[model samples]
Target: MHEMSVALSVVDHVEQAVRPDGAHGVRRVHVEIGELAGVVPDALAFCFELACSGTVLEGAELVTRFLPGRASCAPCGRTWDTGMPPDMTCAACRGGATELLSGRELRITEVHWSAEPAAPDPGPAPHPEESR
Candidate 1:
């Protein structure tokens, strides 16, 4: 499925972003998926798991935020939720002229890195006089 490819691409992005900074791996990732993005969340999740096998992103939590599709009619200067429809007319003025404002977004919003505990720093050895 295409979702598998998409998942792999996402993992590539996350790994590239975190690996340069010494991150051991990713703990979580947040992505925004719009109603019109044409991505199936369940399929994506399933593919993600497979794609992440043996990778730094393995077991990383995938948080998805669903955004509603929105469009605005230029003639009436009106905006409304477009739901899942491919095309819509202005509800206020019955105008067919419209431009999409939001939706069709499939992007990563944030990434959380696995927290590795820092090594403890030993203070300087006691002075010779104090030791005596």
Candidate 2:
């Protein structure tokens, strides 16, 4: 499924974004997916887990928010929800000319980095020059 590719891309983006910060791992990733984006949420979630295997994003939580499709009519200057299988035509004036305002986006909004693991404590420094 294309969702796998989408998931892989998400992992790549998250990795790239966090790499500069020297993050140990990812805690959570928040993304916005539009209804018209054509991405299956459940499939993407499953694919995301697979895509994160052995990566910095492994074990990270994937949080997705879906945005409803919206369109604006040029003739009527009215905005309305297109819903799934979006109807591009305007409801008010039945205008054929319309502009999509939102709901085609597939992007990462935030990435939370996991806390760095604590270093093990060494007991103490050994005495110097104990042996001659």
- Candidate 1 C-alpha error for residue 67, in Å: 0.7
Candidate 1: pairs in clash = none
| Per-residue accuracy of model 2 over 27-93 as CA lDDT, tens digit each | 8889999999999999999999899887878778899999999999988899999998889998788
* Model 2 local distance difference test score: 0.86
User: Tens-digit lDDT track for model 1 on 1-132?
Assistant: 787888998988886773545577677788898989888999998888788777777778788999989999998798999987765888789999899888899999998887552233466999989987
Best candidate according to TM-score: 2
Off by over 4 Å in 2: 18-22, 117-132
Q: Each candidate's TM vs. the true structure?
A: 0.81, 0.83
**Model 1, global lDDT:** 0.82
Residue 46 accuracy (lDDT) in model 2? 97
